[model samples]
Target chain A: MKGFLRQDGRKGIRNITAVVYLVECAHHVAREIVFPFRDQQVHLIGFPGCYPNSYAYRMVRQLCTHPNVGAALLVSLGCEGFNRAALLEEIRASGRPADAIVIQQEGGTRKTIAEGHRWIRAALEQLAATPTTEMGVSDLIIGTVCGGSDATSGITANPAVGRAFDRLIAEGAGAIFEETGELIGCEAIMAARAARPELAPELLACVDKAARYYTALGHGSFAPGNAEGGLTTQEEKSMGAYCKSGNSPIDGILKPGDVPDRGGLYLLDVVPDGEVRWGFPNISDVQEIGELIACGSHITLFTTGRGSVVGSAISPVIKICANPETYRRLSDDMDINAGKILEGEATLEEVGNEIYAKILAVAAGAQTASEALGHQECSIVYKSFEPTGPACMPA
Target chain B: MNTSSPQLLRLHEADNVLTVLSTLEPGDALHLGQTVLTVGKRLPIGHKVAARPIAAGEKICKYGVPIGSAVCAIAEGEHVHTHNIKSDYLPTFERENQHSYFQPTP
Candidate 1:
């Protein structure tokens, strides 16, 4: 199938209007810019920092220039240090249209709000009028994350997601599964499955980096309730979590917002890129979704054994239920019943197909369970990273 | 309840514990291989029950791997939780108090 070709030669699954806040100070202006559009594809995204840093700048630049985004309006406070010019240059380099408006320069709040709204409306009109071509499974990059997991997660939904991912990879789609802190114990096993045997060194280095990062931060990603739900160690949780990758050979590692160079299964190193600073890579469900969106995921498959109802601002989330009880209790929020495998109602293949079908439908413009319910839960945390240790990467 | 369908359940042959898809109450007849036994307590959905007697400090298995160790001797069909089991591996996070908090009642 064909796809909507962008100026940068990248194909996009969705044409979006992104209202960007240059700093925390400009959030209101950016949000107001998106308010008039009111289209689900028009989203609000920003960094809350007034002081500029490389990580923040890099993340903002990637997000603004994401293929899914057709155009962007950068809202800035005239006195902030966010470097709006550099960001606009990055977007312009991608050949995507981006406009930066400074609140202080545009007269004041009331006047800037009026000008920002007008600018976004004009951008949206041009964006909406852009012609779109048909897209194929191979052209899609999808990501998966499991939150509020339990024992049933490993037995059903997570593996069923794995199956769907395997099918996607077979169809040449790029798939990413992340959270190395959760995969602590399964590093060696995962390393063996890398597409490039040498890539195994990079794989272990990623997980080890996560372990060291979390250790330095005074917390492991593991929750106390994980033990109550029959999980004993971080490795046990890792084993269950790792199943979401299916059996596809891991291609390579990409930091948040870095697009995959090839189509296959890839591990997203969600841990921060610098020393142990900021906080965790993600503070909640939507932050990861935001990162995936920045990385150019057209959709996200979310597995939950304990039940999570959050969605993202830019992409649709298909929530796959991993536990029979959780499915029963939160059927309204679930798109696939993977728990049926354990209850003997359906096979893994059947559930996997159900999830894959849901992906197609979502891509075709059908609202997911989370989308229909309007659950736009988003968050981002801070973390500083030190480079990977030699043993952490694949051998 | 139909306890006759234990054969339908696939307990990882290498695992020391088995997960019950349905709830099991105390005194219910349970069939495990050639061994016939009665449930010792009511196990909730998604909870694990020891398939066989496990001695103190012995590794408790799940999914064919040692998830943790038994803190005390546990009878078959007993509910396995923090009180009866403790993780054998050190956690990745720093802890000020290094002692286990699990204590089995009887």
Candidate 2:
């Protein structure tokens, strides 16, 4: 397959020009700036918090310089705590065309919006000249997350995604599965799959941390819809969600912005480190998608039993519907009918191969159902985390 | 696909619960090994039913792993859910505006 090669030597399947709003005050201006280019690859992404956060800053920096991004326009409200200058400089240093427009300094909303349009016009021209290079399976980094889960999720879609992940790892690709809060009961089983023996305790510790964090908050990741869909408890739901990880040996643990150095299966720890200061680890599925994209995932496999129509701003999301009835009702929004496995129409391996093929097709420029339907959802919330320990990433 | 496919699926040999592959109503026959049992209640697709008698406080196994523990004695072929089982880890969050179609037993 072919990909857009960045100056940092990283390759991206998409070369999108991102219009970023640094604070909630600049969100309208950023949206207006990208409104005219809605049909194009220009996407709007931003952090709504006026309070500066290291996690948010690092996430924005990584996203702006993501391999999928060709150019970026930073719209700041001038007084917001986010460091606009540092972020702009970082993006520029990555050899990508980047500019920052502070609303307070640029007169007002109208003036800044006008300036953003002109900058985007020039950047789009520059991005059109980005060089393409040969991209192999080894160059791909894929992530998986299961949302709207039910009993069928474990039986069909999640395990099917696990199969696809296994195949991807064998072909030398980086695979990531997250939501440590949902993996409550599977810690021992998951830790046993760690690449190195030292990584096992670290894995166990992270899940324990997630459990403690949720316990303090009085809510696990379990949702009302999950219980209504027949899941009895958090651990029951966790076992279903854990099937998305497949059977690969855990290579490492990654924070939101930590990109994998080599091709292997990595677990993304979405829970905060110190305390549960932030409301929920991830308020919505979109937040997890954003975190995955920040870690440089080119494509995300989303398994849903009840149904989820969300797609991310940077990378394409392939929705795999696990419930046959739900699939029948929402077929237009689903890319793969993994529910066929439950209905005896298809086998797990067959559906897995189909998913693997769909990933390559999406990377080679095929729009997923979510993308075709214009589902470019983006969200970033305040979070905090300490760096991974030495044992977190074993060689 | 066959229209008369099996309505219930036993995921693991050690599992005490069987997943309903299709909505089962009272009197629907469930084939389990050498014997056939009748559904005792209206259970929706994706819900779980007890494959055998489960005593109170016993671990509820699914996928060959303990998902939770039964809170009360459950008879074979009876519906198994939050009303009868509780998480061994954290509490499951339930929204106040829960759907009224299925009410939890007090």
Candidate 3:
């Protein structure tokens, strides 16, 4: 498969002009920069932390150099702790154009905004003429996450996404599914799908780690809305959630920022390695979207039985509405309706094909509903990990 | 017609209860393996039903995991919700006047 070859030997499916905020204080300026250039492939995404942490730095660095990004403009308030120079250097080394506009050095808001606009215009022009390679399924890295689940999720959208994942893996696309906290009761089934038999134990251990971590936090990721949607127990929800992974063998386990070396089906272990520290692996759906982008997913298949209208900061999010009634209310925000399967109007394979087609179109530069509606939300929180346990990354 | 065949529902093999996919009124017959039981109450879609007789203090199993335990004795095919079942971990909260599985129809 051909792609826009980056200096780091990575391939990009889309050429995106990224506007980044250096600190929470500079987010307004970054949003302003993207407001004017929201057309085409210009996207606004950044961490909103005036006080910098190592996790934010690592995530921001990886996200800036992500293959989907072609050019980046950093908005800094000048006094923030973010290492602007290091970020810019990393993007430069990856062969992507990057520039940092310091608010203090530029004399204030008006001048800085003017300079930032001019810099973005010039950077977009330089990046506009870059050559792109012919791309195929092999060039794609796809991830899946389901939120706002209801009873229909397992019967419809989740399984349909699983079918699509199966086809993607068969076609040599890198596929990933995450949310360890949601895999509580289905560990044995998940372990059976591991690439190696010995890796099965590691799979169970990862889910156990998530359960223990959430238990320590005094609240499971499960919400009251889940019960209203007919999910009686955490295990019931886990069984339904596990359907999104399909029957493909799990290729490997990857941390939040770890990109897959080989394309197959990889389990993104969203739970941190040690004791409860970060509060939760994900505070909300968008944060998980950010993590998927950091892991190099160019597009995401988001299944929602309860109707979630969220899009990622970098990649396109294809919303697959699972419940027939929810689809009726949120049709404008959804890209595909797998709920038809539950209504007996369509088969899971048919809906899966529809989702797959939407993915290709979105990857080819078509805007997703969330993207067109300007929902570029991002979040990164502080977390401490004690390192992988003995059974985590098993031999 | 498929008498010998096992019931197919969302309930895992390890589960002691089965989920109701459609509403069932009292006296409706339900078959699980060789056991045939009549509904004690109307079970709403997406709610749980007792697959076997459950005594108070017995753990409630779904997807083979203990979500909570029964606070009252529940006969097989009886509707399982806040009225008869309760959570061991959290307070049992209910939506007042809202339709529960026991209420067969609106």
On lDDT, the leading prediction is 2
lDDT of each: 0.76, 0.91, 0.77
For model 1 chain A, give the 10-residue run with minimal summed lDDT.
A386-395
Standalone chain B TM-score for every prediction: 0.67, 0.77, 0.72
DockQ of candidate 2 (2 decimals): 0.73
**Residue range A95-182, candidate 3, lDDT tens digits:** 8889998988988888888898898889889887877777888789999999998766876899899999999999999998999888
Residue-level lDDT of model 3, residues B1-106, one tens digit each, is 0112222254467677775544467787777667888776565545676778999989888656676678889887666665666554433223443345236755
TM-score of chain A considered alone, across all candidate predictions: 0.92, 0.99, 0.95
Could you list the iRMS of every candidate?
Answer: 3.9, 0.9, 3.9
Off by over 4 Å in 2: B1-5, B96-106
Weakest 10 consecutive residues, lDDT, candidate 2 chain A?
A386-395
Q: Categorize the docking of model 3.
A: incorrect
| Angstrom error at residue A389, model 3 | 8.4
Ranking by TM-score: 2, 1, 3
Kindly report the docking quality category of candidate 2: medium
lDDT of 2 at A344: 81
Weakest ten-residue segment in model 3 chain A by summed lDDT: A386-395
Candidate 3 is scored at a TM of 0.86
Q: Native contact fraction of candidate 3?
A: 0.12
Residue A116 miss distance in model 3 (angstroms): 1.0
TM-scores vs. true structure, each candidate: 0.89, 0.96, 0.86
